[model samples]
Target: MADETNNPDLEVNAASVSDGAYTLIIADFSDTDMAWEAYETLKSVEDGRSVEIEGVIVVRRTTEGRLEIQKATDHSTKSGLKWGVVGGIALGVIFPPSILGSAAVAGGAGAIVGKLRQRHHNHELEQKLENAITPGHSGLLALVSDPGEIKIRKALERAETIVESTLEQVEADDIKAAAKEVQGAHA
Candidate 1:
């Protein structure tokens, strides 16, 4: 969900059999710049350490035939006008203040900005998915890992729940691998 991966047109794939490594497939289905982003967020639960839960981001083709490029700038913009102001003010420091200000401002004002950005990004992503979706073209994001049956199942279930409406369900094996070919073509 974080904008670390700019892949706007994401397709998540999580099958029970992919072992324990999360695999992300990014397909540039549009003529525009690859609009996709992906990154993992690690959390420390009560346990001593947690498994490195990974997130996969994939670009899918839409019915409208436009690549859903969730721009990085868009994400930052959604973060907030306040952060922009703070960032600008901090920039005035022209030194360590810029770096420190970023962290501090992001923590306070940036929090609101992050939430807004994420909310709008998700909304836009959904809209683009709806618009680009065609009968047979869809971008995909799959998170697969041999973490464990339980983990794998949970991941797959999560993906299924999110992708059910936007895309036609298919076995991971059945999901044709046009991503690489498509990406190469676009590149």
Candidate 2:
């Protein structure tokens, strides 16, 4: 949901980004196995470019064609506890509730999970994410910062399709608020 008014189209490259604290990269793999492999490879990705990978997650379509989070990590953040992309509600907003499609009702969290779709721009973002990862394909979402964006594309060479979006602090704060609401209800 990177302010659809300015850039209506989702871009494959985010070289235009400047001064922003974060760049969100979503890479779709040819197959589910490839995604898992890419996820492993990501851990060792370093090119001296200083592109910090803040958080990352690998998701694949389950047997029923629903998105399933296979692995997620926040890496370096927080005081001690690792931060995760999904640990907040960013990933939740990327995939619509229907795509989650199962006994997702884990009490109040389930109801709050659906709140992402309620936002207009999030729906468009969800549709884009859905389109990128077709049946049997998997997606790797990364929240990165600093320069050398190319390092990410190179590391994700196996990605069949890659899209990058700008995530400003304002939008991130909104996501955090949504996550807190969901957690508060769950608690």
Candidate 3:
């Protein structure tokens, strides 16, 4: 059900990764620094062979309330498509459609997407995202083999708010494909 981390800074949190679906974890932190710290910690743990993470992304709402991807891995092309699937789905889910293009479609926060979503999904993941990382906060999004992985437990503990969801690979692929289509249209 859970895996413990030897690192004192982290602790076991919940179920580890799943087999038929991907476990996406979004953790909100008061500051971007903390979020980034957790991201690094996750990677470090994976490097030590303590766990396996498909991908990790750090997202933040700037002081202006715009959603921005502070850090993301693009290894889907280099390592394997599986490596970046989680992050891709996250960006596709959270980024407002206006931000997909050059303009915000509204007056404000030119650096990040400002909440005018072009499309919608039936799932409550959108609302969950809104609650997990409010404006001006930071978040860590990760896809782990198991949510119970010690490294995952430890990193997620750093977040002030955490939300966990499971999605079949096809669902995630749909999200990614949709996002890419939007990006392509903008391009």
Candidate 4:
């Protein structure tokens, strides 16, 4: 007889996600500095009450044609840190520091890709993110759960940033592949 308790699929399905609804927002900036500024601005904005931000990552292509990924170390917004933790953990699974090379990595990042794999799946978001951030430019990718579009928009507007591409209901696999692809290019 099979040990049902040992079934990986069942275990994954049992894992609970604090929030199910999420939107992947990829905002491009004129420069890497602007992208980091926008990311900080978004983290500082008081829009969490209306929207739950699960995670945020910044991607930039250097003039030398290399890719860099950065995750938030400290977030100011409500649940920003919480979601940032989740995002960090997820990223740990997708892009370990060894593979990341010189790219910055956050604390508490672990191999939890198995957990994320159970919750989300889609590569299009990653592809879009890779395409949107070009050399000399930067992009901010965020995973927000059930946000009030208007409020988030207003917050971003206040930060003086604009969205390049927005994909709602993204999956973990998509994010993983994208990160992998970016890391792969450099490797």
Candidate 5:
């Protein structure tokens, strides 16, 4: 679940990047409680596999479709034809077109490898993109890390559309000013 509280000062957030930790802007929930709830949901997903997401920060965007990201998380997994056949068989049951049925059968021999590979990247990238956007509100999801943040950040930059990035500093005043401008324009 994502926080969708509307804030007049949605863009009044800044990014702080250091050698150890990074700052991410995300949506501003109604209160600390809602933010904490969303954080818990994300934290609980660490079953040891997915790129260890340290935390999730929500910054509201005054603009409609802007996603500001810092460090991107790259998650790539590989599988062979066997998995594709198994998957295609399952899919064919749901989609019973003549071509699709034949494709599913042929996939058993390894034709589905390309399909699965494409799907794998698509799924991973799509998940990251979704994480960046809120359900209703428009904004960005900043993912910060220490040494390993580079790879993650690159993956995000490649996959996402609108990304604004800057070093974190005591620049909340500037951000607040920018937020005011955005709000005024939108209003």
Candidate 6:
């Protein structure tokens, strides 16, 4: 799941980003719903050109201690199709496959989803997420590229969400090895 929107004309007010990645952990949600609400709010802001959202995943620890991960989908396409009668450009054209592919593999295909998959395959980050968000709690893990910090902060604040931890200028390999020190754990 991805935003798929690559509007070059879309204005983004942010400082020049260095060549690297960043990880933001939004935690302390009262429930999964609240976390999703915050995610939706952030997505809406991303849609409106407030910030550059690269990838997002929602993690929820169920009452029975199961970890659930939710990825972002092309909601704009669904919404446009549902309201196609209103007469507007199809979202597909606005967000072409080529653009989405380029964005996904901007740094490298392995650097984006690969890291997330590594996190899932190993139990380190998953365990940390589970521990941070106990049963009945929820959190969000977002990989943003040169995000507009002010806009993102305002959007989260408007949604009444608080960020628990943030690691900037993060390396993809470092993220992939977050749980490497611990062995014999599987997702």
- Highest-lDDT candidate: 2
Query: Which whole-number lDDT from 0 to 100 does residue 127 have in model 3?
Result: 51
Q: Which ten residues in a row have the lowest lDDT in candidate 5?
A: 75-84
Can you rank all candidates by TM-score, best first? 2, 3, 4, 6, 1, 5
Best by TM-score: 2
For each candidate, give its TM-score against the true structure. Answer: 0.23, 0.64, 0.62, 0.54, 0.22, 0.44
Model 5's TM-score against the true structure: 0.22
* Error in Å for residue 125 of model 4: 3.6
lDDT (10s digit) by residue, model 2, range 1-187: 2324333332344433334666667777768777766666665673334555655677776656776666454353432212343333556655666666454222234445455446534544555566556667787776666534555655676766677666666555555555556545544
Q: Evaluate model 2: give its lDDT.
A: 0.56
Runs in model 6 with CA error above 4 Å?
A: 1-20, 47-50, 70-72, 75-130, 146-148, 158-187
Residue 68, candidate 6: C-alpha displacement in angstroms = 0.8
RMSD of each: 18.9, 7.4, 6.9, 14.6, 20.5, 15.4
Provide the clash count, candidate 4: 3
In angstroms, how far off is 123's CA in candidate 1? Answer: 33
- Runs in model 4 deviating more than 4 A are 1-20, 70-73, 76-84, 88-105, 108-110, 114-121, 157-187
**TM-score-superior candidate, 2 or 5:** 2
lDDT to native, each model: 0.27, 0.56, 0.55, 0.47, 0.31, 0.38
- How would you encode candidate 6's per-residue C-alpha lDDT over 1-187 as one tens digit per residue? 1112532322222222224455433444656676677677766776424465544545555676444444344232111211111001111111122222222221122333444443334333333333454565565545444444665654444222333322334433343233221111221
Taking the tens digit of each residue's C-alpha lDDT, what string does model 5 give over 1-187? Answer: 1112432233332222322332332333433344444444444443324444433333332244333222212221121112112222222221222223233322233233333333323333333333344433433343332313443333232121323223233222222233233334434
The C-alpha stretches of model 5 lying farther than 4 A from their native spots are 1-23, 55-187
Off by over 4 Å in 3: 1-20, 47-50, 71-86, 94-120, 173-187
- Give the C-alpha miss distance for residue 17 in model 1, angstroms: 12
* lDDT: the better of candidates 3 and 5: 3
- What local lDDT does model 6 show for residue 187? 18
